[model samples]
Target: MMDYVWFIRWFGPSDIYSTQLGELAHRVVKKLYGLGNKKRDPRQIGRRLRRVEWAKRAFDRRGIHTKRRRQQAVANKDDSITTHYHIGKSNKKRLDLKTYTHSRDPAAKGFWTKLQDHILGRLMQHEFDGDTHETFTDDDRKHIRIKDRKLVELQTLRVNYTTYDIRRDQDTINPRNHADVMMLSPEDEPGAHPYWYARVLRIFRVQVISTHPLASTVLSGPQEMEILWVRWLGVEPGYHSGFQRGRLPKVGFVDEADPFAFGFLAPAHIIRGCHLMPSFSDGRTAGLLQTSEPTAARKTDEIDDWQFFYVGIFVDRDMFMRYFPGGGVGHTANQGFFQSTPDNAENEPRGEESGDEEDELESDSEMHQTTMPPSQAQAEQPFAIDSDESVDGESSHDSDESFDSDPEGDDDLNETDVDDWQWDDGYGSA
Candidate 1:
């Protein structure tokens, strides 16, 4: 049937009457009339109809309900932290702007007062002369003035607007120094060997202006915060060291770490701590920091080769010495300035693959066995049986053997064909 598939396709079924032409014609007629709901196959039509109905139902649905949305809490009179400020949505919503809730900071009282006067003066272009004051009662005039002042303040300040002091401590290890190295956090790449190295570019402490989950935990002083900005050195196509083989780079690393060499940012918590390495002149030995130390202020070389210490993960002194016998795993000048440790010894290949392996040997032996002449197979097993033997094993005997001496006596045996002989169940002699 499979061999004749082309014939079946070329010359279809002989009987056209047996085909479902009638059903197809009926469907075509129904489609022309736009008669959807009728005697239809539910398996075929039900799903399509359901999808259409679903789309129709979803067409006019509204966006997220106000209750379901997470609303930000703004500063209020009831807020306990008077020192720290916050912003909340105001009652009046105009255009797309929500008026800023009034700040009760004691420090801003003078500023707010001056701002109010500046705003009111612009509105009251005309002087309120005695003639204007005489028309309204003193209480009414005062109330109007107060309301206008409040309105101006609200209009001037925007909701969600904030400001904070960026405190800089020159005492701490300055990240901008470029000498600072940090331990990378495991959370950066979860479910992996997360300890990595990065060079710090900047560090600063500031007051957090926005609400976030980590705000409370991260804030050290009153509204003050700290974070470390870093530039990550890539691990993919990573530099191998004396100890370890490189890992297949995770997609996250490849995607996030710009292969073309660009900078990326990570928070301070993601940085575990600072790591330091000793500088050496030879770029190999890890003796005292003195061997590399400037001894009599020697002239600097044109192509400076005195770069030995790098910002990276810290291994114990003993382990480092064991792995790197020369005290440092120096990089060839062409490669990047980083090194990697091997994963495991077992997974590393003992030697490169070649044609003379055990598998190749087995394959060669098989080919030799297969190509040998039939005469060799006969020589290997000359007495091999080709057919089944009878229960009495008579067929297995050599044909040249002599069996003319009959067990039964010659007088007792009658003339009969040996092939057609019929004997009693028990031997008559026995």
Candidate 2:
């Protein structure tokens, strides 16, 4: 056999050949033991040996004489190639670092403050004059005039008034000459001309006692005041049929009823002492709360006639105070005429009694006409519906509780006696 001394020397246990020495040991042991031989040509084996030697020499030149160093050199080359390939393929670039920036101007904070001041200054000077800040009153002729004028503006539009008979207790489409009906008008109509328009604010059946003097009172008046149901018609284009009239321009005939006829049917008594004029607007017009004397005086007569004919409609303020007594007017902040009474007490009437004690007592007695007798009051009081005997029997059954005890003698025992009992008998026997 040819001497293979260099091959064995090269695969020896020195640091330079440690890995190859392990592989050679495996092959030699397998062959000697008759396990098998690795099938590799001499040329291929020489190529693998050359690669290992080159790695070992490179490691040694760097003062890395250990087996670990040689392996590390080979691994390092692989890592370097991977990192270079990734860098060459990618298009990533480093970004510039940034610092935060802030504004130091004082004017930014003051912008809104300046705007508010300007607006408030203009509002104070142009609108709320000193006298304008004073409280308004229903009794104030100026205020009433303004209210009437505004009402006239609202009433210029066409509206409908339907009559409901209290006597019949049902609605009648075609009202009889003297029959009553409910009426309605809108509070505000969108996109309409800003002028006096006809609106059926209320409807109540008032007896036509005399058309000549035009004198009449609310059918159920003073004591049992009737509620005049009002329907506010908004400003919209529409017509009023037979017994109906269009706008004021369409009122061609003498005493010809407008579509909304309550304004023409009103009797004098209801509106005699009351002020009727345009006092306020829906704020759609400039100077909404302003009062005009001439316009109000003229409209007073017109509205008075219209209101008298239209089932004697009253303004909200007048109606509230008249019917509701202490009910507050305009805004709830305004004090009401009536004060609340305690549960057990009666609400004393507000005005002074016109007659003597007997008359006052009679008035008080009249107020109780709708009240029931004391016997009825007692009967209405709540009490148990069942008999006293049945209640007593149920209570007795609930009170009984005496039949629940164990009969066994073993139920009670001293703690020491129980503890002395044997528990390990089965285990000990086993």
Candidate 3:
């Protein structure tokens, strides 16, 4: 079971008091038994145990603590924070607008302009009730002012979210480590998927000040705020991704030309980190953006993007619950946004292939409100796609805890096929 591994990281421990201490004690006793010879000298063993106990007592009297004990002390301090989530450590030196906007790194390109509009949007909706909040306009955004244009870049984000069992769990997201994330979607379309997926490109907390003449009543001073810069991902058109299919959902990066392709995200809206595997068989292509202009969306000088990626929903237990109907009790806020339930299976999740003649078919580019031309995309791949033979594999584990082919709780399957695979070919199950 991977439960012995990632599940522990996901939910912390089963309880404040755990059974590992007792098991470790037994292991120590077995080592002490080795001190006895073949004759099984009981008295000799007892004498050695007593001396060991004496040394332990003496060591404790000196007030020295083990690494585990010191870590627990720090964890206790973090538990006192009232919010379910909090930001963690980062670099000490802060970066200004000039450093970011003028940097040669592709990640920093156009960051200042996007951040300016983001601040204006937040300021416009500061204290409004219901749907009456003011929104950003072309004229309104230009008038917004920021204090000193200073920003603090963060390295880690610790998010504590409710699990499927109605318990709390935490996930740590880092831009370089665990960047993929999921968030609740507010859309109410029928047969719509419940969550929005994105990969965090950068993280920041800046002081926002609005100097718009029409918004003087909204603020008196600068307001400190936190936001995540993310590259939005969309589900593959006409892919069957559900528990019934036993295959993970496929998602891909939107065409870089799309306006909302990259935007600021509120950390408060994040659910947890997600695991996405590249669908190697689909191959890489440069048609998505097809631009030589410098972009923050992709790595420097990188001309191609992965054709598709699979959302590994089965990677962890909590992730599975998030997608299953009537399976997540804590996801009440998004109760109505899940895929079509059993009662209404006729309408599959948006972007899924349908056989009905009346239903309008959505092409890959049509899935997102993008102005990018479809003429540049793969003309061979039809809009009404069927399950690709590339994803041919079955879950070999028999038990619920046995999630994958590996029994040691490691994702050995995904790591397979890399040795003999060539860059020209796509990947399949190991």
Best by TM-score: 3
Instruction: Estimate candidate 1's alpha-carbon lDDT, on a 0 to 1 scale.
Output: 0.29
Q: List the residue pairs that clash in candidate 3.
A: 280-426
Model 2 C-alpha lDDT per residue in residues 311-420, reported as the tens digit of each score:
22233323223223222222121122123323332232322432366577666444433243455436532321111123343322233223211110001111111121
**What lDDT score is found at residue 14 in candidate 2?**
36
Model 1, span 1-430: residue lDDT tens: 1212333464565345334456554553444335345555554455544554454345425432121111212222323432221212232322210121243321122332332222222233323111122333333222212212222101111112111111111112333232233332333222223334444433322222322222222233223222233334434343333222322211111122232121222232232233445345335321211224321111232222222333333333322322232322221111111232245544554334433475785675465445445664466432222322357743432333221110100011212212211112110111
TM-score of each: 0.22, 0.16, 0.60
Instruction: Arrange candidates, best lDDT first.
Output: 3, 1, 2
Indicate the TM-score of model 3.
Answer: 0.60
Lowest-scoring 10 consecutive residues by lDDT in candidate 3? 407-416
- For candidate 2, the 10 contiguous residues with the lowest summed lDDT are 406-415
> Candidate 2, after superposition: displacement of residue 53 in Å?
99
Report the lDDT tens digits of candidate 3 across residue range 196-304.
7888877777777766875542456777777888888897876655654445778998775666667777787788889989999999987776666666566666777
TM-score of 1: 0.22
